[model samples]
Target chain A: MTRLEDMVGAAVRDLADSAPNAHDLASVARVRGRRIRRRRQALLGAAAVVLAGAVITPYAVLDGWNGGPRPQPVASVPPSTAPVVPVPSTVATAPAIRKDWWAAPVRLPGDLVVTSVGRREVNGPNGVTAVAPKTVQEGNVALDRSTGRYRAFSGGYQGFDGAPAGRYVMTDDGITAQIGILDSVTGQTRQLGHGSGRGVEWSADGKTLLLSLLRGGVRLIDAKTGAAVDREMPDAIALCPSYCNFTWLPGGEEIAIAQRDPRVERSEALPDTVRDIRVFSVATGKPLRTLPVPGVPAGSAAWSPDGRYVALLPDAAEEDGIRIAEVATGRIVATLPLVEQVRFIADDQILTVRGLDVGVYDLTGKLRQSSRLPQDFLGRGISLGRA
Target chain B: MKQSLEDEFTAFVADRGQSLLRIAHALTGDRESAQDLVQGALAKAYARWPRIHGDAEAYVRKIIYNDRASAWRRPGRRNEVTVAEVPDRAAAGRHDQDVTDRIAVREALLSLPERQRAVLVMRYLEDRSVEETAEVLGCRPGTVASQASRALNKLRLLVGDRPVSMGGAR
Candidate 1:
């Protein structure tokens, strides 16, 4: 073998060596043994004989009028008019406004099937409790507070509007975000961009949208003009080797992106090991500051409502817990241990969901209040505040 | 049919179980996962033993390929490991070893799109005929050839001049 080939072979062998043997052929043998036994028993019965020699055909002979079954002819009818509403543009090219949006107060389509539903309640920081209907399934229903209507955003996944102005992002596979604009009053639904990529964030004015593209960088869509602004960051700035998750500050002037340095050994195909948090000016697409975020996993990063402190769940235990870093100093002000995902409910209170319990934590990393969600509700989709 | 299947399954396991585990290891780049995959495939084949026993090894192999492909399809299954940054010189030196070379190959295999990887593994490493691979993968022979070709091209790109000749058997 060539030296290079030998080297690679050895490396592969080492990797294989490290793999646990618990998943070995014996488990399969046990399972297969049972199956084989069952199949043998089933085949030993008369059913096997019937299946093997099943040439038995059923023939129906019709003697009526000395004829076989005859085909019936029917009269053609005129096409019915339901006022075919033009198939609304799947692409959200036009400006997204309350008037321009299509499906408001949208009802669950008759053909829309509900996969699964369970009773669930979410409690926010300031004693804000919202109990959704027990019949709601994941990726199907969202409550639009403006219209007081439950709109079904059907890209196969559903989410509630945590932000105001009747907008919600539906994510399929928990990665790609499909932008949906629901009329707050009518529940009309219009989906924007198909597989345009994920990380859809609304500008503070709710006029612009931010989306991440697979090839590279992020796309800024002006919901008002339908003009898209592609802001290309250097390949070195890629959050993860594959993709980055983005969140817009309340001001929307600056966007916070959690990105990992791609030119590193990644533990998984995608790792939340975000080495840097970059705050970019939305107007110029110029990075305002590049702050080193040590130990933050590469999931979603939440900005404080005031936009002063950015919090991330640490991927490494020794680095920090809930990293409350100052945007200006790039200094980690506080670390809260064991916090996995964080969302800001108010200035002082933050909603932290770890496992099944959602707790409100202060900036100082103290738990204030906690609430229990029915098993797997938080697992489905989690967001703070009401739709 | 029942007796024939039992005999076939038992014989197939005795002949090919270890090899399946090895292939699973290569695919997962982890022994534990590889074992799990092999076991799962065996169970699936055993369950359909009456039908699968005609070509039990091929049937089990198809299950392995499908299982690996589905695992790749699952979202958030990729685990990212953080390695402390090594200086460029050290990194280059680290690649000089046999283990590093294997690591490179494993990574290259993992980097391929799942279907392409399955085709490449089944055709090249497992030494299955194109038609046999197509049947196992539930694809046309043409698709198997195309996927294998594409996969080889990708491996060439990743392995660079590492001599991944298809004819070479170790």
Candidate 2:
């Protein structure tokens, strides 16, 4: 072969080596083939299948793919053998599936006090407590979902709002702020440690907290005991020129930082110039791998429940979509067609926002269910617990 | 019979999946995109496996080439450069030179138009003849020749001609 041809061939081989073994390619293809087949069958069956609610086709169940455990049948309504009992006209209809948390919008005056902003759910799997701003300017109000009452708490930055269940970290001052952890469930606050910090971030599992110091540095703290954990911090490049915005990879052992160009002052410059995703080991304080981002990954990245995959929002210049990428190899697995926002509701399912509608999509980027968001939904103005 | 067909398809994938992935990786320069491309072509082949299993590899390869070519038709998708940075010089060693050459070639190949990139990949990496490449890409032999010439010339310009001690006539 010509030297150029040989070099080109070698280059291709080098790139191919970086590609992880796609062992599941055949099964994924089979699943797609079945969908194509079923689509053709549906076209043939038409109204019959539509009216009958379409029997769920039995196909291969991929490992860790549950196709989203949501949008279930309105009622189980088992096959009836006997005569149906006639119900009165006043009898209520069957209960509907609970909507995703974001679907329910909270209005300022009606649902919450006008002074209270930044509504976020906390405590319990079902979110027993929701914290919002109080009428009094001194502190925030935590509303007990069960009791329908608000308890006010003092001293925490509204910007760093979301936290672990029943507790949130706060500081009394900006520069020499004494960090304290408050248990919103009980009216008690405990000093965490003798440290001065600017903001706090809870790891994905809520086991660790990343406290950004006022004088430029970060400390890892045990979320439960508030003791300083001896762990390595991100490299110097990740901290300088701008606030080190970090997104925790699942399991709280590593973090992914999208490198930014400090020279560009405009806010849009970060996502515009983001070319690499630097992954760091929290224990070693060293870079594990730097993956070249395919497109300019804009906004924050959402890690899948398994941490095996991450969903990144495309740059604003491109059409709205979620680029689902395998975390280990940094390969774009699938790009959801059109989504305004995305987060993982399950390991295999992602909650997506399209205009005013919120949709649930499987890993294959197929929409499972779609419903409109509430009229007063506070998109980024609010945060759900454990973000 | 259906189970047997699935089993046969699985066996074929096991045998030829990696080769197809390599060709796709050469075409798309990104692993996941390559896998997606291979999966897509394989899915198409699987859909008609009953009729096309005899020529499944050829059919899947054709799909991969055509899909990649079609991607060129979409505006603003001409380039899929995934390399974060281009090194100025190779380290003072032969192994480092190999890495540098690969990176430079990959970046240059990605910068080329999709059709030209396809032609070069098919000609050099897959070792397909001009006629075979044309047949797969559904183009004239003359078109393939011209595209390959332009792509090679551009690659030479993009990455300096520091060829290894390999020798052959194009």
Name the candidate that leads on DockQ. 2
- Separately for all candidates shown, the number of backbone clashes (residues 3 or more apart, or on different chains) is 37, 1
Q: What's the chain B TM-score of candidate 1?
A: 0.66
**What ranges in model 2 sit over 4 Å off?**
A43-387, B69-79, B82-84, B91-99, B161-169
Q: Which tens-of-lDDT digit does each residue in A1-387 have in candidate 1?
A: 445434444544554444443323544465435543543443343122101000100100000011123211111112222321223212111112232122332111111111122123333343222344334443335445544444444433323332223243323321233445444335454555533223454443335656644333457765544567776554413343222435565455555555665556653212234567666666777777765554332232255544455565434223234676654444665566433346554434555544345466666676666654334333333332222
Taking the tens digit of each residue's C-alpha lDDT, what string does model 1 give over B1-170? 46766677777777777677666765665433465467767765766667657777766666677652223111112211111111112235544644454555566766555566566566545567888877876669888877766655555556555445542322
* Two-chain DockQ for model 1: 0.09
List-wise, what DockQ does each model earn? Answer: 0.09, 0.13
lDDT of 2 by residue, A35-55 (tens): 444434443442111111011
Candidate 2 local accuracy as lDDT?
Answer: 0.50
RMSD per candidate (Å) reads 25.3, 24.6
Correct interface contacts retained, every candidate: 0.20, 0.34
